[model samples]
Target: MNRNIKFDNLRGFSMILIVMGHFIGTTHFTQTYFDFAYTLIYLFDLPLLIFISGYFSKDNPESSIKAFRTIFIPYLIFNTFWIIFIYLTKGYVPADMYLVPGFGLWYLLSLYLWRAFLPTATKIKHIFVISFILAMLIGTVNIDPNFLSISRTLCYFPIFLFGFYFKNLEEKFTIKRSYALLILIPLLIGATLLYLPFNSTILILKYAYASLHMGNLKGMVLRLLFILISMIIIILLNNIMPSKKTFLTKIGKNSMSVYILQFYFVFTIPDIMNYLGFNYVFNSTFLCIFYVIIATALVCFILSRDKVNKIMDILIIRVTKILMKKTTP
Candidate 1:
């Protein structure tokens, strides 16, 4: 089947943002930075990716099997690999890495949870509203993020629902690109300027107000604002996003490939650079930004290649077949 250029492009766009965020964070040296760009990206990148996940979603009970095949199986394989890799490299692995998930692995587990429950979830009327309430409510309890990625899963659920509902929008939604840009650009600027380092945890939705040293009332209010603003950002992005073909189209089409493959590089690049006596980039924001851009371009270029995607596709298919054969009558 032919892929949607726009969808792939958006995935590419989101995937790059994910890379940019992680690259900036994990490499953090004297670049021990928390500024507007980082803050702003954290606010929407994962949620946007989750929304994209739902755009392709269907209300099918059988999708749970698909989720098990694709999302769950890959997550288990990678999670185990990540654990072993960390054990060898870092000297100790987390006891709950598989159940709790690491930073990059959360989305895969969360997506599996979302996909597995989707059919039953869709049957509930007003599920979007319920999901939003759940997102807000989940923030009240300080659930350790390492525990199943449950906090993020609930927090991002409504945005995913919005994307699902958006799939059926038959001209009910229309906006001028000029207008969307007018709204989005200012909002982006406002969000950037308004962001602070301490506020970063709220963006991830992984902790309670107490855990963040915020009052419950204020946290709830801000959380509500974050969710609404993110929706607006996504809607504006949809209206303004270009449909024309570009390199990002291929990157976006094979976005999951870029996503999983980049994990191999995100933490290593900075360390490799630092060990080579190239610490200058970490000292200056400009150099750091430039470094990440070059790194991001390289990752997108190499990881999104057809051959790499084919290999991953083949691996997932074979693994799924094996799992099915072992379990089925």
Candidate 2:
């Protein structure tokens, strides 16, 4: 597949935001500013990532299997790592260790689910429309949080399909950077302020659940608005950013590594900080933001190395080959 620099840059940018979001979420916060930043990041970061993954997904006989290995295998491996990390660190077994995905690992499971289902789902005409309505309706269902990975998968399925089918939409036009900024700046600010009233619920919607306090109708309306707003923001982001070789572009190319490996740091850093007596210094909102930025860069640098890629290839590629052989007979 030919690489699209614009999408690569977008992916890289989204990954950083995701890392930052996780970092912010893990902090023990009583600060309003930290909550605000975390909410803003949560609003669109993973949705954008899911959409991009769909955009890059190819439809082929082996595509599902390939995507499964590429994503799900790593998820299993890393989730196991997380389980061990938790047991060693906290000295207790979390009941949902195997049943639910560990922090930051659910995306891989969701991605695999989307890819596995998309081939058949995309065959129906007006699928995106149909799937979106289903996504909206899904918000009304009372489901267990243990079912979250699958619930969120079904909810975001429309956006994923939209990305695949709306290929031409990406290049339909480009907005001037100045104009894009002029529009996006005020739009984001206005949306943030308007969304603040429901900020508490808006944060949980990212988990693909209806707001506990809001009615189903209101929840559906707000969820749809989030979908639209997220799409617009991602469009403007892709249009306005420089689509050339840069650090983010480099990070984007190695996104898989960063995505898979960054969770360890995000989950462990607080304890590490506390152990080192730097918790007081690093717990501030500004310092947490700085920590997220530096940590993202460090993760990208460390995981993008050839040695790490080779190790990943061994796990994903080698296991894939083995599975194929076992199934051949």
The lDDT per prediction is: 0.82, 0.74
Model number with the top TM-score: 1
Over all chains combined, what TM-score does candidate 2 have?
A: 0.90
Where does model 2 exceed 4 Å of error?
199-201, 204-211, 282-286, 326-329
User: Cα RMSD (Å) between model 1 and the true structure?
Assistant: 2.1
TM-score of 1: 0.94
After superposing candidate 1, which stretches have Cα over 4 Å from the reference?
29-34, 326-329
Query: Residues 64-111, candidate 1, lDDT per residue (tens digit)?
Result: 988888899999877877888788778998887788786588889999
Candidates' TM-scores? 0.94, 0.90
Backbone collision tally, model 2: 0
Q: Tens digit of lDDT per residue, candidate 2, span 67-104?
A: 77777777777788888888898897778775788876
